[model samples]
Target: MAGSVRLIPSGFEFVDDVWGGIYRGGSYMLIGARKSGRTLMGLQFALEAAKQKEVCLYFTNMRPKDLMIQAASLNFDIQSYMNHNLIIVVRVAPPNDAYAVPNPDNYLIDYLRDIITVVEQYNPSRIIFDELTPYIGFRNIELLKDTFLNTLETIEERDVTSFFVVGEPATEKAQQIINAISQYVTGVFQLRKSQSKINNRFHGGNIIITPNVGHTEGQFNFKYRIEPFKGVTTAPDVDDVPSKYADIKNSLAAQQKTAPHYVYTQSKQDKNEREVFNNVYNYNDFLLILNNQIALYKSTGQTFNLVSVKLNAMAQTQGLISLNQLQNSVQLSTERKDKICIKDNVLMLLIVRSNPNSVVHFLSRLKSNLPSDDIDYVETVWENISILNIEVNQDIENAEELTEESLNKAHQDPGSYLPVNKFI
Candidate 1:
């Protein structure tokens, strides 16, 4: 029996960490939120199967064919497989002509028929449907689901493994539709966003794999990261940085002295040294705070703004003058504690739980704080921060050993898919 086929070498950390490998003859469903790397995840699996000299068919209804090809090439470097005829693409055009046609009800049927024809023609070992969300827009949900199930059954009988990418359900109705479809697939993998406790940044989501048809040798709930060039990668250790950035019980000590043009009315210290007021904090600390706020905002829809201020060389040469100027500006319109800091000579203001109107006012005030001669020269940037969720895979590092035939297949023409200019 062709029980399991390793899509990538076990030596590759991604294969070992995320998925032991995709099982042979498995129909999988990848479900994730919008822009959560669902399409990329599907493309990655398709590319891996194609690398084994297997015919792979990709079908997408979300993006244009040219743009999808461009993204696969630019982001994952998978264009060569398409060039070599190992990967075939089929784009499902939307029903723009449905309203004009005499028989508009046949749109779904026609679409599925076209897909089946392509699948039969390609005779691919692996098939990837870029998305299954568009079906929800159709009026006959039950019929579409029935047709989809029948299609999958036909593909399975032919020994062609398949993957279907579905957007994360937004409403109860959508969830019900997905639940109905989920029962037919061999496996269901949910991709979602998981915040890093250590860094407080959106690394990627935990992939929840629930095996259905095959023997459940390995299933997982693990964190994964979506990387550029390479699609998915195991995230760093969780405890790399403790979640201590938000432990600010008291304010950081203020400068002792004041600048000639700027004054800190809210400052505590009274030291005479002008150099003592260089308000810069460590860059890493800034990242920690930024990540923490991002996670906080994601959990609670409360808003926060990040304002970055970059000063020029003339301002830096004057020691604490630039720092005092920025501090005075931020303090005038923004909260002092837990709001303003200089990271690597750049001043960053964290407008906590504030809306857009107030943030704009704060930016204007900060701009006014700069020196009259150099006010126009200084650069200021601001953004409303939000959490980004990315889709990734699951893992089973020490799962059951593969059969000899499967192992032999993994080693055949190992680097055939690798370009000569792989480093490039």
Candidate 2:
């Protein structure tokens, strides 16, 4: 009511008549079942936004090239806009090739990092994040909440808008989670398939937009269909946020003082901000898991080798660059199930379900995988790094003993990779 509302049209004349399209700089959620035209609707919206001369960042799970082709098929010739960078399509995923990581939280961190990097680099006013099902399985409601909360904060800081897509949840609990999270957004739109009464094939679909912005009342719906060059269609990417790209981005004080009278009360920051990553583990977190495993092993008779990796000139704790370098080495030398803990120049690893004898071979070859030790963060050469191990069992009360013993063994030789320590 105070500031003017910049409405990004949804490309549908019927729906925009009442709601006045989607607000600029606001994040919105679009929920739909499979084949419910979620991707189509997002694509159409992106096309329309580009038409209004807005720079759009379309993050799709599909290849950017293929998404461009699909956009052209929808009667929107976007090639010129693509060349001009009016609509930049990016195939979004975590930085690491291995999607699965030891810590689920780490995975989310890396994914969020990717999003942040893209936003900072391109600085697009609008963003479209395609699907949520692939990343947030809805198996973890906490993960979903974290993803949205962080995304909202990021969008607000940049003053950009976004559209995050969520697949229709089958379970009641998931729907409940969605309902709970919805309070933080400016709007929630549900795209449902309106099937034909005759054959049950998709004849058309409907969109229910429940706008929280302005003096807009309860939700409303409209019918639509996909024909050749018709109903809807990059839709390449993950669940979205930017106040929404099609129709999304967020804030409370910001939204309140601005055009729309809506306020987005953010989810509490009660959860840890530690991101999901494929590459590294926070030392404290890894230590807790190590102790738990030690306790569990005492009864179960399951044992794991404790490899103490010492990088020379390494600080007591790892910073970002060094950690990423170490993470790169871990990716090259260790298995996905293996857990690494770094503290005070020593990197302790629990290579799960691995060969005791092959551990030495891994250590021998790992040196070759280290980044050029000449790099700035790495003060000394790789020659100073020592990889040694000790067999860990119930007798070892905690991780400290395991690492301490292995360090002693490495100190004994100081030059070459040592064999498994026989002194329990």
lDDT of each: 0.54, 0.61
Roughly what TM-score does model 2 have, to 2 decimal places? Answer: 0.50
Q: What overall lDDT, based on C-alpha atoms, would model 1 receive against the true structure?
A: 0.54
Candidate 1's residue-wise lDDT over 222-331, tens digit each? 56666656655564344422233112111111111111322324322211211121123344555566566666666676656554444444544745345555454455
Cα displacement (angstroms), candidate 2, residue 357, comes to: 57
Alpha-carbon lDDT of model 2: 0.61
Residue ranges of candidate 1 with Cα displaced over 4 Å: 1-20, 62-75, 96-106, 136-141, 194-203, 235-424
Candidate 2: misplaced stretches above 4 Å?
Answer: 1-5, 94-100, 138-140, 197-202, 233-424
Candidate 2 on 1-424: residue-level lDDT in tens? 1225566565654445454456667778889987677776778777666665566888878765667667766776666665445677776653343356555655655565577788887777778888754555434667767776777777757767778787898888767767756766778888777756213533566767787655253476665566557644212122321223333222222232354311223321111111112334666667777777677678776667767775544332433235445544654576656777766555777776556665766654454455543455333334345567666654688866766666565566555453222211
